[model samples]
Target: MAIDEVLADLKQKIDEKLPKGTTISSVEFEGPQLVMYTENPWSFADNGNIVRNLAKTLRTRIVVRPDPKVLVPPEESVNKIVETVPVDSAIANYHFDPDVGEVIIEAEKPGLVIGKHGETLREITKKIGWTPKVVRAPPISSRTVKNIREFMKTNHKERKEILKTVGRKIHRECTSKDQWVRVTSLGGCKEVGRSCFLLSTPESCVMIDCGVNVGSEEHMTPYLYVPEVSPFSKLDAVVITHAHLDHQGLLPLLYRYGFEGPVYCTPPTRDLMALLQLDYIDVASKEGGRPPYSSADVREVLKHSIVLDYEEVTDIAPDIKLTFHNAGHILGSAISHFHIGDGLHNVVFTGDFKYEKTRLFDPAVNKFPRVESVVMESTYGGVNALQPSLQDAEGHMQQVIKNTLQNKGIVLIPAFAVGRSQEVMIVLEDAIRKGLIDNVPVYLDGMIWEATAIHATYPEYLNNDLRKLIFQKGENPFLSECFRPVDSNELRQEIISKREPCVILATSGMMNAGPVMEYFKAFAEDERNTLVFVGYQADGTLGRRIQKGWKEIPLKTGKGTEMIHMNMNVEIIDGFSGHSDRRQLMEYIRKMKPRPERVFTEHGDERSCIDLATSIHKKNKMETRALTNLETIRLV
Candidate 1:
């Protein structure tokens, strides 16, 4: 029976025995059963018998254990696994159930039976239709450490032979000595926006993260414009790093051009890109210009995506192995890793990464199997990009909010719809719950709320701490009752004009475009409201201009310049950035088990890449190449 029905049945029986004016204060699920606490005034005999009768009636085992916290599943009458896979020489013992599936292993050496990749056990389960678990065989007291060594030796030998067969098959399908694998970033070379990278191999071609140049162009176009359709026609996949437009805006245009392949991403990215692409179309339409692509085109693109897990290695082509790892930049953002040939020329591309753990996601994992070369980004490569500690950053944000609330003015945070918006919400929620700030309405005005919802769907991809905190403590920090998602324009205007102390988190953190611009234009002259920046503001963006002490900004409406005389405070918090800083990058390289022979740096300006290359060469005594777009470097 369902849990709700079981609870209802228990409630009905309890209410029949209780008198009027009595109340059941609590009903909780304890280990092995349900427990109900009441404010009744009587202690009746046969209470234990009544509870036993309730269990019988519900068809579920229930016991009133002393602690009331011991809940366990009811015992079954039969040994299910033995019925199918009988105790034979191949199997020492078997225990199986419908829910958890079957487990068969060797009594002496379970590790040897399972094989290194669990190939032996997994194959059995696949054939038998039951889940298999290899027992961790404990060492006998007589042998102790010696027994462990012997068992592991046997296990390694058996597992290696089994894996060798499987590896041979995989190798045959994914090796190309004559094939070419080259990635060129035509744009997004200097700054964080206009992210476009080209990947070409003999067997397949792909481009990951084709976004627009928000920092430079008045109207951003997809990076796919840089490559002709003939090159893209041979493409096998176009993987998006995340849903942020700079990472995913020009996806639909791929279909418009005539590229049709599986758009691989995590499930949350698939859902978020749907909403974001539609918004992109709407925004472009409102501007009375040629929109990038139609909504139907985006749907078509989404339909072809094959959502996979973080480390699932799948073949995009006959000779290409692709896997996604958590990048910790935004919800569903991934660092693409390619194991391309028999030589295992492993290549790791950090689409955008956060080396430090954040509220919702874990830091990027730097370990890989012999990474030949790394294509890294240096958005914050300049000496000025170094960030303060997380505590200091959060403290400044809290102070800004407190000061703005004291003045009874709204605080606007123009954050990116993905990572920045989520980080700000997490900090704000914690601050509010701890009574650090007054209870004020936190309005989510742009695509921020939708993005938050997407992040919630995939908690496993987040940091280990976040996963534990979410699952164990039952905390949904992003979906707190304090946040109000504003959708309608009328409601947004009403909230903005209320003259109350509140927080407004909008999209387009750069102030290049999106709802943040509208809020800034409305609140810039107030002198009471404060605009807090929680992310990097690229040069030429309104956020950057304001940060540089620009007194006035040219309005998009072309009316005139708007003077910012408002007491509007500007504060920047840096720990939330997704990229690793200079120190972190160097430390990561130093820790690699097998140091790379050659390191090529791209995704940053000419100066930053050269500086990084120079540093790596001087320190590690290795060849470091500062790569330029369209310039190909031969490996091997």
Candidate 2:
């Protein structure tokens, strides 16, 4: 049957199931949802279970919206919302999107706007004829979030059309019945960067994690030239596991190559992906390198994004149901679980997961309804890769900072702008509050400050302790007074020149670019200063070279290359990395509910990947393979 026939059958069934007084004006497909426009939306308002029952019976998500003809004017709707919602909700802004018949209310306290069991929201919708979408206003303002929200509102019509097109394609009739699933590693196999994979069935094709390697020019992007990945438009969907450049940097390149499918991820991941992609272009331009994709391509990606919360089962293709589980590697990092052919097979891809808990998030989820094949990362899966406990790592870090401050010297810590920066901030704040370390100035340089602001915006995604501190206690560690933002080059220079004992956190975690290099150049010759490594440093990066005890390093300068002597103290505090170590990886597999029949290891050095695969096969008596780029494996 054609897609129109399928939708027609669904609409007829829906009309029959609806309440007696409910009248359907139109039925439309919006992405994965079937939206019904009604003249009287309140007919079924007394019993919310009607929609749930319809959804279960149809085996698809359903959304009911008032017909546009019945909707109140934008101005009148805004006035009614303000009057209905309490003043203490701290409504920061109101945005009306007529295309979706939604009035977005950004407030500091979204619960108050929702009222008990969403009574207030129902009242506003019934009164104004617009669905209320409540969003929490970030305590720390985020320019990226604000820009994305504004762009979404302004382009709602275009976005709605895009969704409709995608919805038609997703719900299209499946032609083939030969049920088989195959996965191809386009990149991020026996390597730590450029993570990409292609999952294909007879009915649909999907790509996961289009990434780039910052440390390598020759092997930067995924194997897009592969025959299986060519004609990018053939892909039905693209799923991003996180906002990290290694997982999503090359996403915009898809849009540049004529791919118009929806990109699925969490809300924070969408915002952070935009921020990182724009910054990637700016950094490449400043460093005199050509960016692969233009800013316009990034904007296209934003318009096509479909944000999903964790554990929300969504259909991106006719044969696949995608569910995201917490990975605990970063804010919004997810382990993608694909249920294919209505449980004919299930594949779980662990994208750079941290099986152990951290200050920022809970440990990676090991439980799933069903899984047959597992593809996991082996970033720290080498046999000897054992890290210290979190408590010991924090203690060591605190002592190092304390000694550096006591000696009246500055401390430089190069951390990833997203996860590591926020984790370090929490640790430092706790140490200072407990008097374990001196209360010295902690300067946030480069994109760390902006990334920290984004972290503050999503406290609910953080660990339990941190969320309680922010939501209940009203004490956000990210807003600690000791952390200061360095926004100007002059301030950076002044901090470098001054002998004041302070702690500095800068971005470009591998020291390939950004403000960390400026501070490193200034502090390299100071014997009393300290440089710490709190995250993974890829090979060929300046950070890795320094870790190898390179006494003098040549660096690019305006006048040419110059050599700088290294005299500062260097510290490598283990256990702070977001990647799970070998022990944790093995333990995760052991603890997994309904153990997988086979496992594939990737996202590590060649030796690490091989070793992990071998160990898992030997210990669990399961088929295991360490795949390389362009290798295809048949799972079903």
Candidate 3:
């Protein structure tokens, strides 16, 4: 059936299902949800079966809001809300938005304000014609969260329009279904960055992880111009698996090019991506490079973005449903699972996943409810890419720090501010607590401090032990007294000049840009100093070049491209990486749940991707392939 025919039928069914005298002013889509604007909302909101039956008939989620004409005045609604709530809620602040017909309530304890079974919320809506949206205040005030909220508050009108426009596009009719699903590798194949996969069925088109390659100076972005992705209107949604620049950096460019659909991701992924996107723009400007998008473009992403927790089944495209599972790579990093065409295809994409638990998160969810084919990452898929045990790695790090501190030499660790920096902080804190390493000043540069604060805000997403340490015992490694934030370049340089034997963790993890480059320049000539890498360094990056034993490096500096000698000790701790090692990658496949029938590998160097693919094919006798960029695979 055509889209118009389907919607017409759906509307008729909804009308029949709703009780008599229930006035529906409008019907629209909010993502996959069917939202009805009604003058007589009490007739629908009060009756549970009305919505349940409508949802079953329509085969989608349903939401009903009071029409703007019937909405109570904001001031009047606010007074009643204050009176209806109890004192325990500690309602920090709230406001009413006539457009969405909801009262946004920010409280210290949102659950307390909401009451049991949402009885109070239903009462409020019935009495005052305002829906209540309760949000908990951050345990520690976060400027990023505050700004995101303020942006939403100020743009209610704009956001409402965006939602309506998106809703219409999402529910638009499709006339064809070939009954076959094909995936086009736009990028992140035969390479480790610029990860994008274009998934298309006759029913809809969706893209996953539209990112940029920060390691490249020329071709830094995914192939969004490919015919499979171009004329962007057909692009239904973008599902970001993680917030790494290599995973979501080019997302704003979609908005800049007039792709106004939604971007689906976890809540932490939303905020963290915004932080990195804006920082990328700032870094580009300072380096005299032109970024593809601007701050405003990233803001557009936040406005259109929809956040779903792990395992949330959301209908992103007409024939597709998306579920995100913990990838154990980073906070909010996910393994993207797609269930397409009512069992026609079930595909899983391991977006840079780790199979083992770390100090930060549980391992990637291995037992999905359903999967027919899987796309896996091969970042450490080579036979020789084995990592030492975490205990040994931590012991080595302690020894390195102890030796460096005794030698009165600085220890510079270049890390991704989001995941690696926080893990290293916890490792150092543990070493100190265990009396294994001496107390030394730990300085955080780049975005580490702000990122650490963001990590603290999402304790529930972390591993059980870490969550217990934080929410249960009220202990957070991020708040350690030894860690100090570095705010000024002058102060950073001053510390370098003072010949301080401190441990400094800064970005970028691969040393393509950021304060890590500055620290490397200042300390590179001193053999007493050490540079330790706790993360993957993409090929052709400064980190890779340094790791390959470059005695001399040509760097773009204030003096305009100077050549510097590297006499410092360079060390790499493979065990500290967020990615699983070769052994873990193989084990990940070996322990598969109800073993997939086919597999495809990507997101690594040519050798690793091919090696892993060959192993999977031979070991399990499963149909598998090592895909390259622009390769398209048809799965029945």
**C-alpha lDDT score of every prediction, in listed order:** 0.65, 0.91, 0.86
Best by TM-score: 2
Per-prediction CA RMSD (Å) = 19.4, 1.0, 2.7
Tens digit per residue, CA lDDT, model 1, 287-350: 6667878987876665456666788666554466778888878878887877775554767777
Q: Let me know the TM-score candidate 2 reaches against the reference structure.
A: 0.99
Q: Which residue pairs clash within candidate 2? A: none
Colliding pairs, model 1? 31-70, 31-71, 32-71, 32-72, 353-578, 362-463, 527-566, 527-567
Minimal lDDT window, size 10, model 2? 39-48
Alpha-carbon runs more than 4 Å astray in model 3: 1-26, 38-57, 67-90, 115-128
lDDT of 1 at 261: 59
Candidate 2 residue lDDT tens string, 386-425: 8999999999999999999989899999999999999999
Local accuracy of candidate 3 as per-residue lDDT tens digits, 273-366: 9999999989999889898899999999999988899987888876788999999999899999999987888999999888998988899887
For model 1, the local distance difference test gives: 0.65
Model 1 Cα displacement at 50 (Å)?
48
Provide the lDDT at 543 for model 2: 94
Better of 1 and 2 by lDDT: 2
Better of 1 and 3 by TM-score: 3
Worst 10 residues of 1 by lDDT: 65-74
Model 1 TM-score, all chains together = 0.71
- What are the clash counts of all predictions, listed in order? 8, 0, 1
